[model samples]
Target: MDLINGFITIFSSPITMLFIVMGSVLGVVVGAVPGLTASAAIAMLVPITYYIDPLSALAFLYVIGKAGRFGGSISAILFNTPGTTAAAATILDGHPMTQKGQAGKALKTASISSAIGDFTGEILLICGALTIATFTKQLGPPEYFAIYVCAFLIIGSVISSSVLKGIVSTLFGASLAMIGLDPITSEPRFTFGTIELYNGLSLVPLLIGLFVISEVFTQASHDHSKDGRHDTIKAKNPDDDHLSMAEVKRCLPFIGKGSAIGSVVGLLPGVGSAVACFVAYGEGRRKAKNGDKWGTGVIEGIAAPESANNAVSGPSMIPLLALGVPGSTIAAMLLGVFMIHGIQVGPQIFETSGDIVYGLFAAGLIGIVLYFLIGWFGSAFIGRQIDKVPPIMIYPSILAVACVSAYTARSSLFDVGLACLFGVIGYLMRVTNLSTAAAVIAFVLAPGAEQALRQSLLLSDNGFAIFMDRPVALAFFAIPVFAISLRIYSRMRSEKTPAEMLDTA
Candidate 1:
């Protein structure tokens, strides 16, 4: 079978297997460290992909993201601090369980739930991408442009605390995207007579500057002079350290619901694990019989958020693979990897790059097993080790590596300087509540969107009427309208809550 052959192809490469294992371990370590995320790690390492084949490069980053999602729960349960925002909800009940000396039980619940959720989402990705790609292949420039607009509006509306800030960040990225050759006429617009500016900006440096170097700057600003100590509570009884079959049965419903919720969220552009985990936690608590006692060290609380967060790792690739749209920040980084390898994404990828696609799918499957093994068997010890490392030591090394990686992309000192500049901008954005993820996605999507819009206009003398002629384009354009209406209605409901309570009184 083609499926069997595809997996076999991946297995034949020893380098790919080696990187998968290395990535899993590295992801776990990085994710266990507070303030470090899988996105930042991948951003720091994207330049290294230049030395490897596409299959190995893609596999390494893909596994890192998958493993990193599960890794965050370790610290959340042990230290009462979430390494990633996706794990923030886990601390609600996870730390309480640790306080109760049921740390192992809570950890097992998180690990198994995460693995099942991730597997479920990956299955959906494989089936959904191929199916959607079949239809997406038939779409023209008008429909593609409409879809891009819909993505932009919906993503900006949902990702940020303030919709205005999100839209502004997205537009800012689009403006930066205009600094090179014009998409339609090939005229240089903002090159400033510099050869380096001719290509606009390289993605590797931008990613390093924004996600990796910015994080270093943020970390450096924190006080790391105090000695760190481990005060992890240990389980006294065997029952406290192991999850029984009865407990697994109790968690199955929550796991299933959470996985489904995460898969759906992942399919939408700009939605991330942080949102999915919280949503799943809320839904799980509402449906449970023990809902009233939900936050009192309940296993279901840990299961719901952990599962949903990891489930987001897989289906987030659906938009990128099927429509060449990056749905999340990690997916945006992966888009850069795809472009670097000279592989065009979208429906044509299956036909022209089938081997690479199948290899990536195989790697995803293997990574799930590898990370699950690590989480299930080694997470407790890993957490203990992470708590011992001083923040003062870890960040300086990271800063040095980030600078070196930025320069390696083109051997240009200018790129290093540019990365530092963006690092400052990124820190400011973080403090200002602006969505850097929105900016990154917009940067990747804007060029394609502009080209499609221009091509559509050239095809029709009637201007915007071309979108009306295509049913698909019209439907795509309508999505943002519905999204905006729902957002406004939600805000209105929230604003009216106090008045309604006063009236009742």
Candidate 2:
């Protein structure tokens, strides 16, 4: 009953409607712009939320997060530029589709897939957060350590362009994570007396540099794939953007499953949108009869990552809402917004702040519709802008914004210098094909993993068996092992496949 009433309170307002539309449109616009990401958009907007109620505040961020994610695909499809790093997978096939003049079909597939993913995530949040939290509580150090091992060996192994490179990247990220103060001992391990190194590396500027800055330089430096066509950008593709009525129905199942993968993957700690989208794309590819055609402009290729990446948006909120621990980088920023506002984000949020919780959910559903309305109706006009918006035009603005955002982190010019320094590091990592995902995930999990390990060990008198003593921990143990084992099996199978022999020809 309260859920119903809460929805009414949020939905009945004209202002809320305005925010939903504004957030969706703006998120898409921002996300479509290279260097302007969903997290940056939401982080920039956190200040405005202070004037609004919690429900409205979250509604704005949620709508923007959903819309911005889809918007990232636009650049990925047209220019092979992923507005968000998660959209990297989309570029594999989406850009190929654009080259084939099927940009309309690609956009349609992306929109529908994204919607399904959004629904899947929200449904999970509504149905399973409490259960999942109760279950997740048993994840002690050993279990968590196992999970990291799985992400490194399993997720990272399959994700990189190559397994050796991926393993190397995972270790690289872990090593960077180890640079900060030793959690158990208070002594700085890798700082070598550098005060800036004492707190370790900050992720935001690092993210800004690694993704946005690297791409800018890559674009400026290389013109290999530049089509003369981007120079004549417009809103809609008149000849080939529209999909046939029957074509839409065919891809729904893949889209639905992709969304499910995104949402489910997003909820698991340490798994980001990239992993969710990759794993989802892998499944969609595996299930495809035209699996061989997957990386080469297939609709399934476009749909899988598109849906999975967007689907991660809704359930990505689950951890933040249920446990106050964020599930993604953007979620971490959103967590900061809540903390800045002096609000706790847990079960009581539903009980004491029922309207806010319910309203946010309701807003999420509405945001889905709004996102489609923008994509289906507004995308062509937006899509055509690719020719008009040059990387050079946007780079200066983004560089300014990045510097300012970094400077905002304590009004320190030193932080601004640090941001630039990390930007260079980010570029170097990309050149080396290092896994930035591993680096960020390790950054997030390292301290907690350290803390949990130390506390659990003390409680058990140094007995390592405490992990096995709990059923939930035991179950958690299976995921990483299974994930790693599957990767190894898949790698072995790929090595011996008929295609492997054909490659020698």
Candidate 3:
């Protein structure tokens, strides 16, 4: 088959194999360090790809993104610090497992789950993108707006312990998104005279400030002893170091379900691994036999989020390959790479760039294997190294990297100042139990949602009825209404006392 031939072609090249391995290793190191992201790495590498073969460039960056996501779990499990936003939910139970001296088992669970989930999503991308693209191409702005609204409501409702706080946090993000030039008019709405503000806040600064810098502040407040012995927590027993067959069997179902959720979420533009991981975690908890123990250092907790996050990597490329639309920031960078190579995307790409596409797919398959082996064999040593480093020394270095990374995104000192500002705000949010995760995701989705809604209104003379006129849009609008009502009803029922329940029964 052509697919088999593609695999052979990629495997025959020694340089391609070397790049895959090197990229995977570099990605793992970068992801394990806080404040550095896969997108940033790819952004930095764009110029380097100019001299390399197109297939090699694409393969190297693609593998880096995939491996980086998995690498995030290493720090999340061992240090209670998630290097990436997607690994946030992993901290719920991952750190607990470390405290229980089962760091090795947690690492293996993350590795195996991530590999299986990535494989499933890659398969879906290969088989289903063409079919999905045909349908997605038909969707108008109204339908897209409806989808964004649903995501906003659903994510806000599920992410926080308090629904009001969650919704408020999301709205705050949306409001900040309105600070730049209007998407429709190109008129500055909230620029306040600064040229840098004209483009609005960069995502890189906001991300580093919110996740990485805020975490540093949080860790500083903790009363961790200076004793090096507490730096690294080790497995308490031989049994704690290995993942058993029973544990793997118990986790298989959750891994499969997480993969499915991630694949579906990935196909939608602007929805990334951060949302997919939490969504998968919520679903896994709902179906778990020991749901009450979900946040108490369980294997399923690590499995669900890790699998779902990595799964998003593959399917997130679907829009790019089939529709010429980049779904995430990484995909957008890859788009630039494709353009540089003069390989057109979309439906016609199959005919014009068949060899490159197939080779890219083959590289993804191999990259998964390489990263899995690396994670499995290298995790213990990595954990020990982290443990050996003192917090005082490590955090200052991380702070420097955070500032530098934020500046490198745009070569602007103003952006560095903006990052520090957000760092303070993020620290306050963390202390207040506000959902920074919801806020960040909402910020990412806000511009697209606003554009879609505005475009739809312009296309119709009947105002909001344009949504009602479209059955798909109508259904999407109805989903949030139904979900909110159910949540309210459940809360009402749960508020009743035990005596009231008994009397009603």
Which candidate achieves the best lDDT against the true structure?
1
Model 3: per-residue Cα lDDT over 1-505, one tens digit each: 6567668878898888888888898777667765456754654455566668888999999999999888888888887878677788888888899899898899999999999999998888877766665676678889878877876776567556667787888898788888889987899978889888888766667766776677778777876674343356767799888999999999999999999988888866556788788888888988889878887899999999899999998888986787665656677667767866888766567667878888888888989998999888897676567556666666777677778777775678988898788888888998998876677767766887898899999999999999888999889788777877886888877986423432342
Q: What TM-score fits each model?
A: 0.96, 0.76, 0.71
lDDT of 1: 0.88
Q: Write the per-residue lDDT of candidate 2 for residues 122-175, one digit (tens) a residue.
A: 778776665655655545556655544444455455546666776676676567
| Ranked by lDDT, top first | 1, 3, 2
Each candidate structure's count of clashing pairs: 0, 7, 0
Report the poorest 10 consecutive residues by lDDT, candidate 1. Answer: 496-505
Residue pairs in steric clash, candidate 1?
Answer: none
Query: Stretches of candidate 3 above 4 Å error?
Result: 1-23, 26-69, 72-110, 230-364, 495-505
TM-score of 2: 0.76
| Model 1 CA lDDT for position 371 | 87
Question: What's the CA RMSD of model 3 in angstroms?
Answer: 6.2
lDDT of every model, 2 decimals: 0.88, 0.69, 0.79
Which residue pairs in candidate 2 collide? 104-241, 117-259, 230-387, 234-384, 235-380, 235-381, 236-380
